[model samples]
Structures are given as C-alpha cells and as structure tokens.
Target: MLVLTRKTNEAITIGEDIEITILSIHGDQVKIGINAPKKIDIHRKEVFIAIKEENHEAVKTVSLDSLKNFIRKS
Candidate 1:
C-alpha cells in the first residue's frame, strides 16, 4: 500500500492518465477528486468488494444442468 500526504489542490498522477487531487479536509474526513478517461472504472473499496462478491455468487449459482432443464422446458 502506498501512503501519501497531500494538501489542498495537490495532485498525484497514476500512469500517464489518471490524477487524484486533494480537494478539502474537514475534521477527519478528506475529500478528493479523481480525473481519468471515461473508459476507466473507479469505485469505492467497499462497493468494489460488494460487486466482486455478487459476481462470484452469481457464477457459483449457475449450473449447466439447470440451464439445460430450463431450455428443455422452454
């Protein structure tokens, strides 16, 4: 994990494209802005983890035999 300290308006660049900038600091919460191409995906850590878990569950619940039965019924 990379830990960096940045003041307001200071930015850290990733690769040649993405930029993360410190916007404001209020109490213990710090606000940051991210700049990247539209093709890039950005998500909060918790949200990303939730999405990954949902995808894993979906894959686990899928069965070829069940799919075949459904197709036959249709």
Candidate 2:
C-alpha cells in the first residue's frame, strides 16, 4: 500500500485524471475531497464490499427455471 502524509489543502494525484485532496482535519478524523470524471465511480471500502456481497447474493437466489416461468407468463 502507498501511504503518504498530507496536511489540510494538500493534494495527491492519481494518473492524469484523478486528484484527492485533504479538506480539513478535526481531532483524529480527516475530511477529503476527490476530483474525477463523472464516468468514474467512487465508494468507501465498506460500501463497495457491501455492494459486491449484495450482488453475489442476488445472483445465487435467481434461477433459470424461475426466469423461464416468468417469461412464459409474460
């Protein structure tokens, strides 16, 4: 992992398109801002993991037979 120390208003660039900046620091909590293209997605690590798990569970609960039955009714 790449780790760097940054003070408020400092920034780190990723490639040519993304930038992360320190917005403020309060006690041990630090606030940050990200600059990226609208087409790119950004999420907290925990939220990303939750989304992946939800997708996996959805796939497991869906069956081909169920889809076929629904199509037949349609």
Top lDDT hit:
2
Model 1 superposed RMSD (Cα): 3.1
Candidate with maximal TM-score: 2
Tens-digit lDDT track of model 1 for 1-74: 99998999999999999999999999999999999999999999999999999999998998999989999999
Runs of candidate 1 with Cα error greater than 4 angstroms are 66-74
Q: What are the lDDT figures for the candidates, one per model? A: 0.97, 0.98
TM-score of each: 0.83, 0.84
Q: On a 0 to 1 TM-score scale, where does candidate 2 land against the true structure?
A: 0.84
Question: Candidate 2 residues 1-74, lDDT tens each?
Answer: 99999999999999999999999999999999999999999999999999999999998999999989999999
Candidate 1 local distance difference test against the native: 0.97
Task: Return the lDDT, model 1, position 60.
Answer: 94
